[model samples]
Target: MTTTLAAGPAPVVARPGPDIASRRRRARTRERTAQWLFLVPAIAYVLVFFGYPIVKNFVMGSQDYTVRTFVSGEAPWVGLDNYVEVVTSSIFRTSVVNTALFTVGSIVGQFVIGLLFALFFKRRFPLGNVLRSLLLLPWLLPMIAGTAVWKWILDQDGGVLNEALRAVGLVDAPVHWLTSPDVALVAVVIVNVWVGIPFNMTLLYSGLQNIPEELYEAGALDGATGVKAFWHITWPNLRPVVSVVLVLGVIYTLKVLDIILGLTGGGPAGATETLATDSYRRSFQEFSFGTGAAVSNILIVVSLLFAVVYLRANRRAVDE
Candidate 1:
């Protein structure tokens, strides 16, 4: 027992030395730095492109920014006066009404026609892909060019459309599509619908492709074929996609400017003056930067509302 001799002063526990610990700490710091480095470009891009403009727009909206401001280098603070004036103006009412009509008409026309096209193409056929690709030409063409062509086609005199109508005896005289205030908005809507259909068809077709064929086969066994199968199986499966398409269509249609501007230039009598065109008219045409920014801010707010709705619906779809 005495020969145990205090167990040789206890075994020495080998803890990390200062050099090793320091190396570990440095490695962790470097890892964190690398992660931040990877995020730097994205963060900077967002700040420069999105953040600054939003802030600048908000600030300009609060100030009396105009041509004078550019010359004097000072935008006087006018608080909500610009917004008040814009909202109280008579054209504001007209613009709002026209915007609603344009958006609704475009969305309805695009979705119904696009869905029909998608369903049709879902069936096997020769040159189906070729025809679908041809449909995309409208979507692919430059907006200005497309609208320019549309203008020629809709011209009151010497236009192909009126020529065809006359050939078929559909009407005795030209429709004055872009000239008459009553019909200008309708003509603009038709052009927009034509442009938007391909987009909707592509998205909806992708969604249709994702649906499992087994479900349809199983549905047929239960007497769910054709419209019955579509209504019971396809529609329920496609509801999420439909919601996304409708919301996106509404949002895009709300902000449409180029087509309307190129086709009607805010129309024969402001018949097609939407908030987008009105904002452009104010900022550049009238040199009322404050009012234009105000109108744009209103539009941004409306868009945000739809975006929020989209987010909620998407989340709901995911949960289901």
Candidate 2:
């Protein structure tokens, strides 16, 4: 005879009480609100600092905002007159050209010298770390102090450089570095390059360190050594880092004011007067805040264009 099978008890289904359901919903809402509260300070900071300044600058560019306007609290709308005056001014062309030269010269000199230093330091040597650390001194010094020292070194008469040259019989007369229009731009570029080299070197050295040694070993096995190996391996690997460095260099160079102001004060026929200095001159020196704002807005546009270029470059780099 077959044994009868016993039926098992049904599984119990527990439903939540309305009170429990509401409590869970309330808990989730509270958690989300807490999270948002954590982010509020940062969001508010950006809105207040960056957003407000940029919008105010744009608005100021369109109005005749002078020193008098600050006292009177009346900035009359002038449309594009500020922009028109900025672009049409006699020194506008000179400032534009000088800005281009300064940016290019500073970036090129800094990157090249920095790359060489980075490569040199890649090899293990005595006091290598110490030397690299010391290189940052120029970068760490106050801009005002650095420029002041450079000013003395580059003085038209009684400067160390001219004296050294005379001692070595290199030149018969003192070279007016900051005084002559032809030499002032070069002097400013030199100072800027010196200040920027350490930054480039630090970044490039870090990038070089990130590259795998095994790749270099493998490359060497295929007769890719020294320059060949670097061209095929190091450069390709470093392209992304190089792009970042170059783009940042361009952006920083574009807005350089303190160094130029301290070194030359955009003097000697406005030879070294960049967009930054020109904007300052218009606003503070000439008391034409509208024109200053207009110049600054134009500078921002130029910076944004470069930013677009950086985006494109970064995307291409990622694709590759």
Best by lDDT: 2
Candidate 1's C-alpha runs over 4 A off are 1-32, 310-320
Instruction: Report how far residue 234 has shifted in candidate 2, in Å.
Output: 1.6
Where's the lowest-lDDT run of ten residues in candidate 2? Answer: 309-318
**For model 1, how does the per-residue alpha-carbon lDDT over 1-320 read when each residue is reduced to its tens digit?**
35654555777899999999999999999999999999999999999999999889888888999989878999999999999999999899999999999998999999999999999999989999999999999999999999999999999999999999999999998899999999999999999999999999999999999999999989888999999988988888888888889888888998899998898899788989999999999999999998999999998899889879777977786687
Cα displacement (angstroms), candidate 1, residue 180, comes to: 0.5
Question: How does model 2 score by TM-score?
Answer: 0.90
* Per-model CA lDDT versus the true structure: 0.92, 0.94
What is candidate 2's lDDT per residue for 1-320, written digit by digit as tens?
A: 99999999999999999999999999999999999999999999999999999999999999999888979999999999999999999999999999999999999999999999999999999999999999999999999899999999998788898899999999999999998998999999999999999999999999999999999999999999999988999998888789889988998999999998997789888999999999999999999988999999999999889989887977886697
For model 1, state the Cα shift of residue 266 in Å: 0.8
Q: What is the lDDT of residue 198 in candidate 2?
A: 98
Error of 2 at 123 (Å): 1.6
Show pairs that collide, candidate 2. none
Clashes of each: 0, 0
